[model samples]
Target: MVLGGSIAGLFAARVLADAYDEVQIVDRDTLIDVAGPRRSCPQGKHINGLLARGQQVMEEFYPGITNEIFADGVPTGDLCGNVRWYFNGVRIQQQEAGLTCVSASRPMLEKHIRRRTAALPNVVFVEQHDILGLATTPDKSKVTGARVQARGQKREKVIDADLVIDATGRGSRTPIWLQELGYGLVEEESKKVGLGYVTQHYRLKSDPYHGDLSINPVANATLPRGAIFTKTDGGRVELTAYGILGDHPPTDQQGFYDFVKTLAAPEIHEALMHAEPLDEPVAFRFPTTLRRHYEKLDRFPDGLLVVGDAVTCFNPVYAQGMTVSALSALTIRNHLHSGAAPQPMQYFQDLSKNVIDPPWEMTNTVDLSFPGVEGERPLQMRFAQKFLKLVQYAATKDKAIAAQYMRAAGLIDGPEKMQRPGFMLKVLLKGIFGPAKKTPAPPLVPIAGGHVETWSEYRNAA
Candidate 1:
């Protein structure tokens, strides 16, 4: 049984269906053929894109799914060459890295994955049900199943299962449930980032990206504000402007435009000037990046495991959540290939050491670089931040360095790849001697004559 029918649970169910006779996905939301964001996923309305590695993993799981999404009008492109990436207001040199980037909204991507998982013969979705808690054995050493209650019903019932996986996301009740079962509390590590972002869709009078998929002005310590202006499945564009350390984007129309004006990418602000608003700006706040040290636990019940944001919730700006969840699913597949239930300790150990550690360290290092973000930055972290800045500077001059940097950022390669002697020497030489040329700002095009209206005005007219 998989608890929570989001992307993580859906992936788990898909993998479990191959090993188990029947895999049941339990969620409070109606899981079948629904479009748009779910009430459970607060960040669903924001901009989301699959990194190169994530696209590869998803394609591996569901063959031809990428083409399917593209057929539905979602754009695809080379990770580095086709997307505009800005670091500290300087554009990274574009190069063909042969990496795939799927620019799809969170809802559209999830909808496609959910549809594929639902079509599996052995997978069933138990929708509109609240997950009461875990049902354990007499000694509470083994999980027998899950207790769930249908929506609006007082009666609760237990669904028996040989194995139970928790993909309940960051709000997982696993810790409290484990404490009740006599097991000690799971260790947790959190870094307070105080991130807030506001998103709004736009129907542009003209294409700003030309043929590119998106424009990203990544946040940095010097200017802790950024935005992702990207093309989505529809004939509209999505802009998610963000700030760190309590600096939040506004939901009001003029306030949102001012926020965009503050972004390093002036093109985004220029594009929005002529765009017709499709919806009122919506905001989401993420207080901290959280991780449950499940691997550190000495004792865990058999037949119980956790995946996705239940284990780690990354800073969304990095766009690592969905990718990490997909990787977790792959780990579960490896563990289940033995035809026996996975050992909790061994699985978590592998997950932490292999899957979670890299991105966790990367994001943490970047988050701590911001002086406003409250976290202890030791000497190593300070040195890493300096080196990363050097690399970013070099990336602006050298396409090879830019491609390699994007490879690491996309999770296609480990951070260690950046530290190799050859790479470090190249970065140093380029930084010291490379010609510094200013990248020309994108041309500000005039808005063609049209009566563009805000969403509120459009609604009022109707």
Candidate 2:
């Protein structure tokens, strides 16, 4: 039994279906044939990126899924070569790295995955059900099933299962339930980011990307603001403007336009000047990145396991959540291949060491780079930040370095790949001798009835 029906829960159910006789997914929202975001998933209304590695993993699970998405009019491209990536206001040299990128909205992507999972013969979705808690054995050493109550009903019932997986996301009740069952508090680690973003949809009067899939102006210490302007399905464009360290984008129309005009990439602001607004801007706040140290627990009930954001929630700017959840599903698959229930500690240890550690450290390091964000910056972290800045500068002058950097960013490889002796020497040489040249911002054209003016000038005139 799975306690949620989001992406993580669906992935868990897909894998568990191969081992168990029947896999049931329980959630408060109606799960079948829904085409839009659920009430429970607020992040769905914003831009959601599926990194190159995530695309690979999803394709592996559901063969031809990429083509299927394309069939639905979603754009596809080479991860490094096709997208415009700017770091610290300088563009990374574009190169063909052969990594596949699928540009689909969160709702569209989840809808496809949910449809596939629902078709499995052994998988069933128990929609509109509230997960009450875990049903544990009298000794509190084993989990027997889950307690759930249907929506708009007072009666609660227990559903028996040989195994139970928690994919209930960051609001998981496992900790409190465990404490109630005689286990101590689950250790937790958190880093305050105070991140916020506002999103709106638009219809372009003219193409800004030419043939590219998306334009990303990544946030950095100096600028501290950024935006992702991407082409999605249904002939519409999605713009998600963001800021870090308590600097948030506004949801009002003029305020949101002002925020975009301030981004490092002026082309995005220029494009938006003539585009048709399809919807009002919406905002989402993420105050911190959280990790529950379930692996560190000395005692946990058997027949129970947690996956996805239930284990860790990274800063969303890195776009690691869905990819990490897919990787966790693969880990679950390996543990279940032995045809016996997985051991709790061993599974968690493997998950922590292999799946969660790399991205957790990467996001933390990047988040700490901003001076305003509060976190420990030991000597090692400081040194890493400096080196990464150098690498970003070098990536502007060298395509090889840029491709390698993209590999690491896509989660296909680890940061250690950039530590190769040849790679490090090249980066140093490029930093010392080959500084990036300044590229002038594109010229802005006047709209139908007005002369082009600076965003500040327009604001003052108003």
Candidate 3:
């Protein structure tokens, strides 16, 4: 049984279907029938795109899922090849690197994935069911299942199960439930980001961009404000303006425009000037990046596990949320493949090592790089940040640095790859000895092949 019927739950159910006879999902919200909007997911209104590795894993889990998303009219393109990125005030050069990523709205992606999961032979979605709490044994040695209330009812009932996984997201009540079972507090680590943003969808009067799916001017020291424009359905683009360290976007229409005009990248604001608002702006605040150390618990109930945002939640600006959830799902599949249920601690330890540690540490380092954000930074972090500054500078002159940085940022490769002998030589030499002249920017065009295809071409191909 899985708690919460969002992406995490759907994915957990997808893997559990192979090991368990029946995998049931319990969610409080009414499951929608189509790929549209939802009140529960405010983040859906913001920019959400798949990283290169996330796209590859999606294909592995649901083969041809990218093509399906393409047929639905979501934009698809190469990560480093098509997308434009400005980091620390220098625009990184583009390359024909074959890393593929998809820019799809959250609601659409979730809706399609939900449809597929609900169709699985052994999976069931229990919509509008309130998950009251976990059902444990008399001595609280194990979690037998969950207690739930049907929609529009006060009476609660217990649904027994061999395993219970909680993918309830940031609002998970597992800590309280565990304390009720006589367990110690789950340790938590957090960094206050004070990040906030406002997003709106608009249809451009003209396709001024040359088939590009996204353009981002990232937040930096001198300029703390940034914006990202992602291609969406109905010939519209979702543009989001964000600020850090309590510098938030305004809710009013005019104030929002004022914020965008102040961004380091002018394209988003320029396009918006001639665009038509398809929907009003929506605001969302992210207080901090948090991680619950469930794996450190000395005593945890058997037959229970926590995954997804329940374990940790990153700064959404990194776009690591859905990708990390997919990583956890893949880990779950690996642990359950032998068919004998593993201990909860073993599963959690493996999860922390494989899924949580790398990305969590990675994002934490980046967040600390901002002057306004507060955190403890050791020598390693300081050195990494300094080295990365040269890397961004070198990226403007060297295509290899630019492409490798893209791979690292996309989660397809580790950042350390850029530190390799060959790549590091380029950064160290060209970084210290500046280039004789400015390098010409790569042409704004998507790479050919299945690696990248315009939405118009995708429609015709389908």
Candidate 4:
């Protein structure tokens, strides 16, 4: 049984369909018959991408899934040739080989996955119901089922299952549920980002960028500000601008335009200002990047597990969430293939090594560079951050550096690849002779609630 019907939940159900006698997905939101909006996912209204890694995993899970979505009008792009990346305002030159991804709105992608999951013979979707508690064995050592309340009804139901997987996302009730079941409070690690986003959808003109989605530019810094404009499935484009460290966008239309004008790249602003507005600007705020240390818990009740955003939520600037979910589904598949009961603790330990380690390191490495980002910096973190700066500086001139960086960004390789002999030599030579100065201090210091204020706080404050 899967606890949520988002991508992670659906993906998990697909895999379990192959392994288990029966698989059921439970959710509080009514599963709408069409590919339109639902209440559970807010980000579904915005643009989202299937990274190279995610594309591969999705294909593996549901064969020809990518082609099917693209066939429905979603365009695929070569990650290096089609997409553009900006680091600190400088465009990283594109490269060739092994970098390819798919672009589509979150709704279309979920529609595709939902259709596939729904078609499986042994899979069942139980919607419009709330899971009240877990039904355990007499000794409370094993979760045999879940107790649920039917939506808009006084009736209660019990769902019997051999295994239960939680993919309820960042605001999961699993921790509270577990504590009620005699477990201690779950260990958690979090880093405050104070990022705010305003996204608007537009209809592109039949011009240079109308049907082609070859370039998507992003800028993420201490004062992380960037814009994303990409082609969606139905001849539409999504233009979104976001700022980290307290630079929230105002709701007024003119203020929105001015906000985009401040981006490192003009692609997003240009598209938004020039294109036809399809909808009003929708705004959302994300407080912190959080990770629950489920693997460290000494005891996890048998027959229960967790995955997806509920496990480790990263800063969205990296666009790592869906890829991480796909990878986590793959991890769950491998564990079942090994003939083991779905072990929650063991699965998370493996996840930290597989799905979580690379992205966590990647995001946290960048976050630590921010002046007042509140998090403990390990000794190796300083070296890694400086070394990455060297590579970023070199990437401005060398396509090889850009390719390697993209490989890491795509989760195709670990950041430690930068420490390898050949790459390390180039970074060293560049650091020694290149005109780039030491990376600057973070532009602001953290104030209350781990929010940041301008650097002048040091000199002007009482």
lDDT of 4 by residue, 325-421 (tens): 9888888888898666777777889998878988898899888787667887888998788888777777766778878888888888776787789
Tell me how far the alpha carbon of residue 310 in candidate 3 is from the true structure, in angstroms, after superposition: 1.0
Error of 2 at 405 (Å): 0.5
lDDT for each residue of candidate 2 in 120-212, tens digit (9 for 90 to 100): 999988999999998888898999999999999999999999999999999999999999999989999998898999999887665567556
Better of 2 and 4 by TM-score: 2
Candidate 3 clashes between residue pairs 3 or more apart in a chain or in different chains: none
Cα lDDT tens digits for candidate 3, 150-169: 98998999999899999989
lDDT of 3 at 34: 51
TM-score of 2: 0.95
Poorest 10 consecutive residues by lDDT, candidate 1 = 450-459
Candidate 1, backbone clash total = 0
Q: What local lDDT score does residue 62 receive in model 2, on the 0 to 100 scale?
A: 87
The local distance difference test score of each candidate is: 0.88, 0.87, 0.80, 0.76
Clashing pairs in 2: none
lDDT assessment of candidate 1: 0.88
Off by over 4 Å in 2: 433-435, 441-462
Clashes of each: 0, 0, 0, 1
